[model samples]
Target: MKRLHLICLLLAVCCQEITAQYRVAVIGSSTAGGTGAWPLDSAWVRRFNYHYKHQLGIVDSTYTLAVGGYPVYKGMPGSYVPPPDRDGPDHNNNVTKANAVLASLPVPANAIVFVNYPSNKYEQYSIAEIMFCLQTIYDSVLKAGHRCYIITTQPRTGGPFDDPAVKRKLAVIKDSTIQRFGVANTINFYDGLYNPADSSILAKYNSGDGIHYNNAGHRELFERVLAKNVFATPLPVKLTKFIGNYSNASIALQWTAECTDPNTSFTLQRSTDGRNFENITVLKAKGLRSSLYEFTDRQPSPGKNFYRLRISETASLVMSNVILVKNPQEGLQVKGLYPNPVNQPDLEAELLSAQTYSGIVTVLNTAGMSFYRKETNFEKGLNKLIVPVQFLPHGQFILCIRYGDGNSILRTFSK
Candidate 1:
């Protein structure tokens, strides 16, 4: 692969060699390359590389391979430009040059790979094309036992890429990729751009032309992006318990202050079955440094309910943690199991019910083996049912009951 641009990957001192210790190669064009007067360590990659290991429990080395004059998908879709000096692939190709470098770079299989797709400036490559290029890169570095991560490019400076006509191209590409792959391997990096019309952030970040991130912009890119890759390392986050309850037609949404994307904010959501959720509202965070964020949903429907806080950033990425609000209409709360250690025929469930509903009671052992189950209707009052002991021999179990739209109530018991 050859390119019209000559992009040298910026490197930093290798941190403690991880399992395979291969360098996590960040591949992209000039925006990703980080621009400055030359030889100053102010680029985003360097900023991320400079101070992150100490913050995270572990660390990995970084190598940036972003060039200045290339479009997101390389050559625009219809028109092709030959390499400026034969340094990379012709200007029209999407990732030919980057792929060649990864295949030839001196890195181990276990290293981390972050490929920032070229900005869709020229409409050269389709989302499908980018996905193909990504898979190729993944296979190339997997031998070193490394993992790959991708940042759906940020909102661009100003160009055909940022036009309203194609504004959604980046987002569509990201969502399709995420649905096909999953959070474990393929991640959705965009946090969803708030105001599509403004490209100031993009302008600040881009290099020579206002297309890519300059050194300062690179710093924002990595911190806003690469560092948060779920595969990189779990960010040690402190989330406050959402302290509130559900009342009548109003379901109160509440959450303690939480960390947010430097470039984005949060939108609260509520779910009855966790599987299906609706966005409540979008809350702007107080800059990036302040922690302890909170938000409340003013409206909640009737029934056994749930509330969750979602974090959105960039243009397409959104993540929700595991915090649930248990306000079920025909709700059942398994407060405490009478005798924890026991040799009894059936366990007891003390349920406080507000409404009557039909539900299935299932008892599972520690290994998730369902030992006992039954479908019974509960009256709008307190009900105590004994679980048949003959179901299992001797052991501890996590008992759960599901009813009304699959909302589950949980409690633990030992025998």
Candidate 2:
């Protein structure tokens, strides 16, 4: 009977090793700090904690080293120095402190760090500088034997973001992020939340301000991370023949893998750009041998689409090679012009573009007198432009958009 009890105890220890849970640490600005999220629990980080503890049966061991309004520079290592007119690192919320805290944890080896400083440094610094700061943080995490995931920039409006040149820079930063960090180590925080017509937060997700996401937006972000299955147990698995194609307004992804463990799972992830990826679906292991699998993305983004697979077993995790598919571009069109009666301080013009280019927007009266005019760049897909109408008299006016490609559009409204 003593031998039987000893055998049971050893078996329990083995099982625990096979299904070990990891600790999560977050370092970021307002969004990760839970601003704009009502009751705070609805914030993405809190929601992730709840899911980790309640659904995954893991201990509530998540820690957030984030503070509101912090930029990437502010979260840098304590040794980092700032450029002229910029503030130095805040040691309290800096990455070095975060690393120190993680090192003191019971299981530092089983830890993952998320770096999310969306759009804070973009306005004051160059893309190269921003990437350098991010690289420093990423290296620190890696040097400590921990995995790191960087969240891409989310959409914002007003202030500097309203300027066409600044908006163009934001696009470059988003693409540069994926180039610096591989797709497997980045998350698409901007994907479904931005209004394609104009790069602002979608109305349903906006928390009354041009920046920050509301509860619905936070929920969407949490779901994105949940779909990532980052907490899954890592396993050694071989995946091959990964490919995808677009047809009939859908993208079909197919792949085969050598599955050894019955506890193995496969997660399909998709991305609009080749950089940040989000989870699409999760599949359980079918057999103990090589098996074929396929999934169709019915609502693929227009133009290039990227797909990859994350296979997880009881003791290992692997990511498949990325594949791309191309879809026809949606042509340019005016989606909407709101506040026609001009009761608000700003009139919004929503547009869908087939490609990216600069355009001139003019607000004119019935007698062809120009009231306001500005030139802005438009990205492919949906975009929203804010036109200030407060200074204009309460009269009929025309909104004319002249494209750089020698094309033009016109809409009429009254204040």
Candidate 3:
């Protein structure tokens, strides 16, 4: 009873530690002001606030300080500029407005300012000018010991930015700035909202004018931001690949990782349904610059086997994409290989055997050159095996498996 009470107390403390409270200030233009988004609450900023409070379990207060025709920089006289101070009344310069907003925050140190540059208007600001204004705001925020997240401009249908060349230039600036700040510090709203086919606003999410977003657009924007900011777990290890193959009545999980730190490790997870996963094993890190990791589940489910990898770090765990492996159907042939085109050094193949047999596996190019040959012992049921084809050139190839019983089969694959 005493131990149980202590465990509960520890769990409570951990939960409290993970739940961080924040004050997010959305500073931008009409889009940030919930313009064109029906019912107001469906706006991206509001949806993000809701998600923060519910999905992330974070107690965050959001405030929008956006106005129509608001540009990040102080444009030239003819350009769209904010009202200037008329001697008695202070001219609301972009920087001044931001400063006022930041000053009003009760806890600036714990605040994260979301600054969206409203450049998709009648006149587009030069990248240099925009960066200068952004740098100014960022410096001010840092001086106040607060963090700032900048949102790049979204696509527009008919604005000056609609020109492909102009849009590309603006994107270059946004991309460079985000790279400077690191992926975690900026919200990539452009990537979230831009239509790849024509570089216009996605039809379903647009409010017809291309400058504003509909409710669904706003929700999608919120979801994308959440994927990078709240839901994502950043890790030091770069995961190159996480895949699986089925054979020998089990599933083999393979992964390639570039471990920057020697202490990095991984936990392999298995799921039958792909939705619910269970940690199958913890593999020790190779602790090298580049390493290959593999784990085999000797008893996978009969049908589809889903696998993922979780890199264990000092502070958090980073998960990989799920890969599926399935037992081959009853046959005397190779079932399948994951990532068929093959990006890694090896490919895993699932083979079904009618009886216990010995076989020779060979991989040949279209030119008939046998680049790889290996002998394997197959069990009566399902057998999983690895065929090294990293040395083969990138193109089409054929895998031939010759059994001692004189039965041979060939399957085509691409490198």
Maximum-lDDT candidate: 2
TM-score of model 3 vs. true structure: 0.48
Model 3, span 233-258: residue lDDT tens: 35678888777777778777788898
Reference-based lDDT, residue 211, model 3? 77
Q: Which ten contiguous residues of candidate 3 have the minimum total lDDT? A: 82-91
For residue 6, model 2's alpha carbon misses the true position, in angstroms, by 12
The positional error of residue 77 in candidate 1, measured at the CA in angstroms, is 21
Each model's TM-score?
Answer: 0.45, 0.60, 0.48
lDDT of 1 by residue, 1-415 (tens): 2342323221223322332233446666654566542454676556556554433423345666666665443422223343453223343233333343445334434446666654544245567656755565555445445556655655554666656545567657666666655656653334322222342234444455544455655554554554255334443233555555556545555555545455556667666554345577887666645455545455454364565655645432434464555544446666556666656665677776555556888888888888778977666668786677655677787777876666678777777
Q: Please write out the lDDT profile of model 2 over residues 147-262, one tens digit for every residue.
A: 78888888888888887677667767877887789777888787667765677888999998878999999988886676566866344566768888888888888888887788
The lDDT of model 1 is: 0.54
Ranking by lDDT: 2, 3, 1
lDDT of each model, Cα atoms only? 0.54, 0.81, 0.68
Predict model 2's lDDT versus the native: 0.81
Misplaced by over 4 Å in model 1 are 1-22, 35-43, 54-57, 71-110, 120-122, 187-189, 194-244, 248-415
